[model samples]
Target: MSSSAPWKQLLLNSINSNSHLKHSTYFQLATVRSNGRPSNRTVVFRGFQDGTDKIQINSDSRSCKIEDLKHCPFAEVCWYFTETWEQFRIHGRVDLIDASNSDPYKLEQREAAWFAGSVRSRLQYLGPTPGLPSLDEQPSHDSLDSSAGPVDVFCLLLLDPEQVDYLNLKSNERLAFTTARSVNAYEYIKVK
Candidate 1:
C-alpha cells in the first residue's frame, strides 16, 4: 500500500463515523492572531469540498474567526477520534465561501451549504450575533418568527490543506503527508 493510504483511510473513517453523531464533528481550529499568537476554537467539520483537497466548515459571517481569516488565511485544524484513538493535524489556507463572492461555483456551493443546515442550525445565525456581550440573562428566540428566512450570516469556509499529519495511538505510528494542490497528489513521510 502507498504511504498515504493509511492516513487517507483513517481520515475517511473518521468522517464516516462522525456523519450521524451530533457532536462527533468537532475539531480544534487554530488561526494566527494579529499579535502573532495562535487563536484556537472548536468548529464543526462540515465535509470536504467537491473535487478538491479542501475541507469545509460552516461559520457565522459576523464571527471573529471570519475577520481573523480575512486578515490571515493560513490555519491549522486538529481533529481527534476518541473511540479509535486516532488524530489528524492539518495545515492549510482558508477561503471564505459566501454569497458575496463573484464566482458562480462558490456561490452555488455556499447556497447548498446554507440549505443543508437544519432549522435549529439556521436559527443560530439569526440571533444577536456571535462574540458580543449580552445584557439580558437569557436571549429570546422570537426572531425565528420573522418573515425573513435563514439569515445571510451563514458562510462556508474551505480549508485547502497543504499538509496532513496522522497519528494512530493504537499502533503508535505517525505519518505526515504533503499534498500538491494543483495535482491533488499526496507524498507521505513517516514521522514515527
Candidate 2:
C-alpha cells in the first residue's frame, strides 16, 4: 500500500468500482476438488472491501462449483477493465458464509443494503426456504416477461484474498499484492 503509485491507484480503483457492475464479465478459476483439478467459470463480481482486503461472490448452493469449493478453497479471479488493457488477477481462498447465527434485525442500513445486493438476495429472497419469490417483483419484470431479473436462488460465497496481481499491457508492467493471516494478524506484502 505504501508503494502504490498513481497508476496503480487508478487501476485498483477501476477494478474495485467497476467489477460489480451488471455487464462486466469476469472469470474465476479454482481448485474445487481435493485432487487439485482446475475449474473455471464466469461469475459476477459482487463486491470487495479494500480496508479488509476481501471480496464477495455468489454461487448457487447446489451448483457444482460450490461442491468443488467444499473440497478445495483455492481460487483465482481474472478480469480485464474495459478499454484499459489492464488485467486484474486475484488469488484467494473461498468459503461459504454461515448465516445460522446471523441476526437480521441487528444489521445496519448499509449492511442491509449489501445483503440486498448479494446474489442470494438478488437471485432469491433469503427467507427460511430458498428461492422464494420476491414480494417486490413487479408485473413488468415478472417471470412471464423476458425483462425479468435473475430468479435463481444463490448462496453467499466469500473470498478471503491472499494475493492480487495487476498487469498493465500499455506499460507492460505487473504488480502483485499479497496478504496472509498469521497469529491472528494480517501480514501484507508486495511483489514486483
Give the CA lDDT, 0 to 100, for residue 46 in model 2: 56
lDDT (Cα, tens digit) per residue for candidate 1, span 1-192: 332433556698877875675556788999987677789988877777765556888888888788889889999999988767788999989999765789988888887777665544566666675633211123445445433443577788999888889888989988898876567467768889
Clashes of each: 0, 0
TM-score result, candidate 1: 0.82
* Residue lDDT tens for model 2, 45-72: 6555434445666555556677788788
Which lDDT values do the candidates have, in the order given? Answer: 0.75, 0.55
Worst 10 residues of 2 by lDDT: 134-143
> What TM-score, over all chains together, does every model reach?
0.82, 0.62
Candidate 2: where is the Cα deviation over 4 Å? Answer: 1-11, 16-22, 49-51, 98-115, 118-153, 183-192
- Highest lDDT among the candidates is held by which one? 1
